[model samples]
Target: MKDTIEGFLDLVKERNGHEPEFLQAVEEVAETVIPYIVKHDIYYGKNILLRMVEPERLISFRVCWVDDSGEIQVNRGYRIQMNSAIGPYKGGLRFHPTVNASILKFLAFEQVFKNSLTTLPMGGGKGGSDFDPKGKSDNEIMRFCHAFMSELFRHIGPNTDIPAGDIGVGQREIGFLFGMYRKMRNEFTGVLTGKGMTWGGSLIRPEATGYGTVYFAENMLKTKNDSFKGKTIVISGSGNVAQFAAEKSLQLGAKVVTLSDSSGYIYDDEGIDDGKLKFIMTLKNEKRGRISEYVKEYPNAKFTKGKTPWGEACDIALPCATQNELNEDDAKTLLNNGCICVSEGANMPSTKEAIAAFHKAKILFAPGKASNAGGVATSGLEMTQNSLRYKWTREEVDNKLKDIMTDIHKSCIEYGTEEDGYIDYVKGANIAGFVKVADAMLAQGIV
Candidate 1:
């Protein structure tokens, strides 16, 4: 067992090759699961953790599509089905040029435990292409989506593997893919989630991640006799997750003053009202443009290039942009400005040093597995609805989502709450999530 752990460490060191953020993510989960595995007699002569770390299936394909000027372009596509012990693989399909097998593998690996933590009958999988959606015409996006889905359709199904949206892939992309899936298969099943309401998509699906994130934050705040009411919030990213997070924060009376994108962020001290938010949404979602367009659309807004406004001061920070966007430097900035709590809207958005900083500061911190789990949880619900051939009301589904998030928070606190009253959610989530899957695997008598 010791040898396996040592060997696993060596492999990680060799293959992953000293990426600070990646190593930090692995170390957090390893610290929680390895000791527990040693204590249990279930794993003997076999390194389950090491085996689980390796992907069950890693697929990469070539995506060739026509550009606006009728030029054929090629991009890489990938799908990392990390685990499926609980159920068919489920996760998001991101469409960002930064996506590669390593990043998607990490996301899918995290999804395994995150799904288990929710007590949902689902497993982990993640796929996407290196095709950037920005600056592409509608026709270009459609062509790309069709080309990508042509190959992906064979490997996924409602009862097999299901996928939804991530950063670059959203409703538009989902719509295009669903259309193609319908054309190819000639059957309309809930194989893919996040469809428009006019189609097979579930209710409250769009708002699930952001709303769930806030709900988790609220539960964490409940532990400390506080809520988001009348607190100031800063959120990075102007995409679906961040936008919805800001919306829920407003509902809870939080004065949210921040939203950003690749170009930079916009700071509106007066708070983002419904009208202003609608404008911002139009700028990003419809226009497929940058956050700098936000200031042009709305007066009394300031845009700064290559700067995050954490140092300006806030009570909560939501880093929803992408992985490692927030680092030790950002953590220090937030700590110096009196940030109280952080709820991740994007998967693994905060670096390990940043997470440690939160712990050292004794401020509330929720890991992405526990916080940003609403998205996949709702996807599970979508699968249930599809299997049953019945659609649930929006209120019913959203309420279920709320309960799942609350329960996930309880699970985190139950396993993560320290004697010192500082819950190490990283450890708590890893242990809690690992126990269920490990026990299940044991009962099944090894695969």
Candidate 2:
């Protein structure tokens, strides 16, 4: 309880009543920035933190699209432009039935700092629709994407706000959205990331977050004189992030045994190799299906219901699913199972209870703001490339992404190296990211 912004927080709690995710975010920053605000003694009551937590703009629209059966389907679409103190709003569009204002607020609030931590000229924003892509025909998906982008196009631009892919919105979705944006705006720009290679998309953008998480984990492990080699890992969420995390882990000589989806978890005693991963990509991205099919295809794998892949013996855990997927019980399972490292690929996947458990266990925990920043970092690069009308090669972009992730890891250590020698990544990421935005805010000066 640092009282740097006590009154404002109290007001929020009075109004919102124990907004755990929101309160957790504020607490994480208060522990770090309070000292700095006291030392600086400049504009304490300006409500910067309060305002930063709140979104700059929240657009909620009614999206109406016609499905393949000549039926008009309607859904709620949202774009929460959280902050723009540093640069244009940059983040992802996740289309899932679970999306709402509170969830999007938590996500967009986290994105502000995550983008800042990348050391990129980007701010924070997140957009999504509650229309689930699962069980939808390609034409239906295309119409939904087009309708969503039609409303979204008016708000986002390359130099203003940029959107990328998340859980449900992948290449096909991006293509449809981009096509709609182009048709409406009548200009070609980097309004979106995760575009096809034939378009404005950059190379290696898809693999950035997953690869970067492992890279950050490796950097953290290196301080303890170790690496990913011979490590057994359990990764949740068999999406793009989890798939590439598996790929990178194999490349780093680690074995990943489990990957899950919304339905349930799949446990493979043997490692999830490239073949299995390809099957997953097809299953998830192409077929738009569940992960239980993975077990059916591989007789050696076992599918379990209503449980995560934790409790299996492992050295590392990567939770790539949505927020609050991992809780206190899951953290205890990981700790009891001898898991040492936890890096988040999704935004705030671990709850406060889970984080406290890891802290109590003294495990190496990297927050999504620090670990999963690779995606937005590359999105910023995409902006730069779009500005210059050039595309960097995969190796070139990947090398730079690696450097950025390393720098982010170093930044966390530099700021998070505390008296107890445990890195408070929440503090490190919030403080480190805040400095850049705070400076920009100061320079802009009463604008």
Candidate 3:
């Protein structure tokens, strides 16, 4: 089994050696999915995994736009149509400086399983640019988004490929991108998600990911007859995911004590309630300010520069930050501090070692693909509403989102239970997500 895994990995590494992030994402899925294939007769000797690893299409282009300074700037943009077996390509478009083939490939690879888990008729893909939106004026961002969409428009459509928002791409950026795509195509369609409510966007789209993460965590806790009624939660990141995760946790009677950004984290022993979370929303979404300013608003909270919230003790920890933000040491610290559950709201936020540590501890740990799938699931819902030319009420959308998360949790349990009865969510998510796409690939006759 070890040799089989290594041989397959060697082949992947030969082609993607320079793409460390993509390799990491593939290796993680390979570890679990290969073992399942060995046990299943239909999947063996078919090389289905190999076919899935390679993208059907990879589009790259140069995006040139004028800045507020009246100077032209260029940035590299990419769209990795990773898989379209189950349905059309579906994923988010990030606009951070860290965007690259490696990262986007990893994201797109994970999106395959994540979308499959959602039980939605959407496939997996991810695209983004190395364009930084920070410190750029509104006109500059609009020009950059328009420029990015000019090239991206040719490859995507309402039925072909649909892109939503990620890291640096929000409602404002989506508005700009959608405006360009609409103009280029001379049509107004649901080619994009995360639009304003007044537009084609669905209700609860912004809050979906965060709300879904907490909902997943709640499901995991229920197996042990536990609940978040009095749990102390620590969440990382101050962005959409983190802020809403905090909001949902508070709504469920849990006390959220922390939120962070790139600069640092703030520890509020008294807990971040509705009023405080509103402040953070404005701070990040409106003012676009640093997290350090949180201390000035609430003197009770202590601002720790250049650190994560893992060191703080809590009953639950949601890593809502970026990839690799939580490492092994942080996992161990959380374990020592009596954290019973860790639900990821970001893509690959916890390192491989950290996951191993969590598994060793036999605690509840949900991977980003399974837990953070709400965003895309809701995006799928948005697509449906857009097609119907009708919108659902907030309660209706929220209820559907909850039902999807519950189904995802059940899927993980079905595939992840071990001989000891411990649920390995990582293993469960990978295999459960794999089976659907693998079957689709088989039926499609090696396309």
Candidate 4:
């Protein structure tokens, strides 16, 4: 079994040797899914995993747009239509300088399983560009988004590949991209998620991922007859996911002590209350200011210029930032500090070593695919609402999101519990997510 897994990984390495991110994602999936495949005769000798590694479509194009200075700028864009075995391709479009084929492929590969776990009729896919939206004027950002969608518009549609927001892509970028797609296609459709509410966006879409992460954590705590009451949580990232995660944790009677951006993290021992949270929202969402400003507004908080919040003492930690933000040392530090639960709100936020450390410590941890699936699940609901030409109220969308997260937790437990009663969430998420997609691929007969 080990040799078989190694052989598969070797083949993947031969093809994607330069793509470290993609290799990391494949390694994690193969580690668990290979054993399951070996035990299940029907899955054996099918090369199903091999086929899944390859993208159904890899679209790369040049995005040429004019800046505010009237200078034409050129950037690379990509759309990896990874798989549509279970449903149409669905994922987010990230806009950052680091966006590349490797990162997008890794994200798309992870998305395939993540979407499956959501039990939604959406396949895995991801797209993005090397054009950084930061420091760009709104008009400039709009032009870039339009240029990006002009080419991408041909490759996606309502029932086809659907892209949402990630990283630098947000409501503002989605609006511009959708406007371009609408103009080019000559119709108003739910071709994209994260659209403005008036234009067809679903309620709770912005809060879904973060809220879902917390809900999943709550479920994890429940297995041990535990809850978030009076728990201290240290969350990284002040983006949409981090903010809402903090909000939900607070609502559940947890103290959210930290929120960070690229500049640094702020540690507020006072536990970011409603007023401080509102200030953070304005500072980040509206002012586009750095998290260091958080300490300025609330003098009680201490701002660390260039560090993560993992060193803080807490009962729970939510890594809502970018991939590989938490390392083995950070994991060990959290364990030493008596952190019991670590839920990922960002895709692949923990490295292989960090995950190994968590598993060693026997801590309750939820992967992003399972814990942070709310955003895409809600997006699926948005698609349904669009098709029905109706909208769900905030309460309706939020309730559905909660139910979906709960179901995902149930699925994870059904597949992840070990003999010792330690829930190996990684193993459970990998196997459960793999079974559905693998079966779909088998039924499709070598597509």
**Order the candidates by TM-score, highest first — what do you get?**
3, 4, 2, 1
Q: How far off is residue 211 in model 1, in Å?
A: 0.6
For model 4, residues 123-189, the per-residue Cα lDDT tens digits are: 9999999999889999999999999999999999988999999999999999999999999999999
Cα error, candidate 4, residue 219 (Å) = 0.4
Evaluate candidate 4 by giving its C-alpha RMSD to the native, one decimal: 0.7
In terms of lDDT, model 2 sits at 0.86
Q: Looking at candidate 1, what is the lDDT of residue 364?
A: 87
Instruction: Kindly list the per-residue Cα lDDT of model 3 for residues 203-318, writing each as its tens digit.
Output: 99999999999999999999999999999999999999999999999999999999999999999999898998899999989999998998999999999999998999999999
The TM-score of predicted model 1 comes to: 0.95
List where candidate 1 sits over 4 angstroms from the true fold: 1-7, 15-24, 43-46
lDDT of 2 by residue, 1-447 (tens): 345467656766675564667666666666577666666656365656766766789999999999888989899999999889898898899899988777777778888888888888888999898999988888999999988988899899987999999888888899999999999989888899989988888888899899988988998899788999999999999888998989999999999999998788999998898898889999987677899998889989999987777768899999987778899998998999999999998888888889989988888999998999988888778778888989999899999999999999888887788897888776777778888887888778755
Segments of candidate 3 deviating more than 4 angstroms: none
Candidate-wise lDDT, in order:
0.85, 0.86, 0.96, 0.94
lDDT of 3 at 218: 99
Clashing pairs in 1: none
After best superposition, candidate 2 residue 368: deviation in angstroms? 0.6
**How close to the true structure is residue 117 of candidate 2, measured as C-alpha lDDT?**
89
Error of 1 at 424 (Å): 1.2
